[model samples]
Structure formats: structure tokens, C-alpha cells
Target: MARHVLLVEDEANIVEAIRFILLRDGWSVSTHSNGATALDTIRSVKPDVIVLDVMLPNKSGFDILQDLRADPAIGNTPVLMLTARGQKKDRDTAMAFGANHFMTKPFSNSDVIDVITRLCDDPT
Candidate 1:
């Protein structure tokens, strides 16, 4: 089965880079840049995985994650939180909010692919 990914990021360069890598790796990709409507997009897209950014225009990724976890329908879908700042607080916050994995900016393409692959493969 083809895996689908929803990328919620605002940076054009980062979005392009990540989209290129993920598409090259054969995953069908959907991109969304607004945080305020990201949750709605997630519900509509129903992707296998989500790559969410920390900061957004109207809403924050942390708030999105928290809201996502609260929704029963899409709550369990794996989330990979990304941020330019690699602070321990961000990682901890991501995990505490139910992120499956957290990655800092400038992540290697292989690492992104590997993490997504692992997230989808694990049965838990």
C-alpha cells in the first residue's frame, strides 16, 4: 500500500526540501502551511503520518498536537514534530503532547525517510 504524508510547515524552503525527498522516496505527499486549519486538513487528508512544524501563522504546532491527541478519530495517527530549534524543551513538549518522533531542522534526508518508515512499520 502507498503511504500518505501530510506536511504542515510554513517555510517555503524547508517544505520544498522535505517534499522533494519524500516524493523521491515514493510516498504520496500532501502539503499544508497554515496552522489554524491544519487540524481540519489532517482530518480531511487522513494521512498515515504527519510532519508538523513548531511555529505557524495563527496556531502553534504544540497546540495542534495537543488538540490532535484529544480527538479520538485521528488521535493515534503517528506524528513527527519538526522545529528549527533543537531545544530539549521542544522535544520534551513534542513527546509530552504525543508526538511519535521529534526532529530538528536541517535533518538529513535519510533520517527523515528512515524515521517515517519506522513510524509506519511499527505495529504499536
Candidate 2:
């Protein structure tokens, strides 16, 4: 079966671009602009992977990651954090919070695709 990816990003243009790329790569993509609704939506959809943004309205991606990890039903879900914050501290914090991978904004589509491919291939 094709992998499913949940994308939580506030930017319309970036969401559209990433959606286009993920869909073209055979991923089932679902998108939401609000982090507040992300957890509920994810529980319902149960995506194979999540592409989350650190800065979001209602809640931050780190908060969402914490919530996800706290819930046994969704705790093990792989997350690829997308952020405009390129600082090492931000990346380190995200990793410590359970994000499976991290990518800064203005990232290459090829890199995103490659990482997601590898993440989905892992036996976790």
C-alpha cells in the first residue's frame, strides 16, 4: 500500500507545493493549517508519517510532538519536522522531543522525498 503522510503547516504556498510533490510521489497526503486540530485529525487518519512545522497557529510543533508521544496510540508515529528555525538548538530540541527527522525551510524537494522514502522504509 502507498504510504500516507499528514502535513501540518500554516503557509498556504508551502503546503500546496509539498502536497504536490508528495502526491506525485505516490503518498496519500492530508493537510491542516492548525496545530490544535492536528492531533485529532491524525488519530482519525493514522498516517504513516507526519510532516510538521515548528511554528504554527494555536500550538507549536514541539507541543504537538509531546502530545503525540504521550499518547500510546500515536506515540510511535514517525515525524519529520519542518521548520524555518535553522538554529542548532531548535533542531536538537526537536530531536529530543521525538521527531524522527528534521528539515529546515527552503529545503530541496528532492531531499524531502529522499528522507521520507527512507523513513517509510524503516521497520519501526
lDDT string, candidate 2, 6-112, tens digits: 98999999999999999998999999999889899989989888899999999999999999999999888899999998999999999999999999988999999
Ten contiguous residues minimizing lDDT sum, candidate 2: 115-124
Segments in model 2 whose C-alpha atoms lie over 4 Å from true places: none
lDDT of 1: 0.92
How big is the RMSD of model 1?
1.1
Off by over 4 Å in 1: none
Taken over the whole model, the C-alpha lDDT of each candidate is 0.92, 0.92
Return the TM-score for each candidate structure. Answer: 0.96, 0.96
